[model samples]
Target: MQLIKLCDFRQPFSLNDVGCGYGALLAFLAKRHRGAKVDYLGTDLSQAMIDQAKPSPRPSMRSQFVVTGDIPRVADYSVASGIFNVKLNQPTVRWTLFIQQTLAGMHAASRLGFAVNFLAPPGPDMQAIPELYRVSPDVWASHCERQFGAKVELIEGYGMREFTLLVRR
Candidate 1:
C-alpha cells in the first residue's frame, strides 16, 4: 500500500495489480481505504493463484481476478510488488529483458502512473543471493524516464533493504 501512495485515493480510481498473488492488495485496500471507491483488477501468471483470489460465494462487481501475464485493461494506476525479486536460475540478460518488458506493459496499461518495488543491493553484512535479482533504483528509474518520459521518484528507507519506484506520467 505504501508503494502505491503516489495514486490519489481522494477520488475514485481504478487499479491493476500485476503479478497479484491471492489478491492481497485488494484485501489491503478493503481494510485501509474502505471509504475510497476502487475498481480493482488482479492478474497473475498462475491460474492457481487467480482461483484462490476469486471470492468464495460470489465475485464483487468492483474486483476481478485473471490469470495472465499482461494487463487486460487500462487502469488509473498499476502496481507490481515483489515481482522483480526472484529470478531463480534465469540469466541476468533474460531477467533484465523481462523486467523491462513488464515495466513497459505497466506503463501502457496505466493512465495516471504506476509503482513497483525491487530488492536493493545487499549490504556489506548481508550476503548476496544468486537467485534474487537485486540492483540500485537508478537502473529502473533511468529506464522509465528514458523510455516512457515518466517523472520517477525513488522511495527508500522504509526499514526494508528494498526500494519502490513511483513512476508518474
Candidate 2:
C-alpha cells in the first residue's frame, strides 16, 4: 500500500481486503493508518488465514472477515489488491463472473470504488501461473472502466513492467 499512502485517503473509511490470503497487507495498512483509526475488514475463504493474523502491538483496531456471499457488509472507501492475478487457472467466464460478484460486494460498501493490480500486456506474471483467464493490463483496465464506470489510473512499479490501477467511481 505504498502507492496508496501517496494518494488521498482523507475521507473517513472502512476498507475491505477481499481474498486476503493471510492479512499481511491488511495488518500493515491498518497499523500504518492507526492514527486515522479506520475500520478495516479482511476476508479470505480460509479460516486458517484469519486465525493466524496478528496485528503487531496496535490498539484494539483490527481486521476480520465478513462472509463471502455478503457484500453489503463492507463500508465505503474499500480496497482490494491482486484479485484477478491469483485466479488465473479458473474458467474465464467463471472467474470474470466472480470478479463481478466480488466488485459488487465491494461496491455495496464502497463509496469511492476499489483498487486492483494486473501485470502489463503479455502478462509479466504469466509464467508458472495456470493460464485460465489471463489477460493484459490494458484489457483489465477497459474491463474495470466499462464495468465500474471509473477511470483506471495506472502506475508502473519500480522494478516490474506490471502496473497498479487505482480505480474510483
The best candidate by lDDT is 1
Screening candidate 1 with a backbone cut-off below 3 angstroms (N, C-alpha, C), the clashing residue pairs are none
Tell me the tens digit of each residue's lDDT in model 2 across 1-169.
5335423556556666676767777567655766555566777767777677655345545456544535446466566666666664577788878777776666566776667665454444446456624456677668778877886676776576456767777
Residue 16 deviation, candidate 1, in Å? 0.2
Off by over 4 Å in 2: 2-7, 60-62, 67-69, 122-129
Q: Whole-model Cα lDDT per candidate?
A: 0.89, 0.63
Residue 112 C-alpha lDDT in model 1: 95
In terms of lDDT, the poorest run of 10 residues in model 1 is 54-63
- Native-vs-model 1 lDDT? 0.89
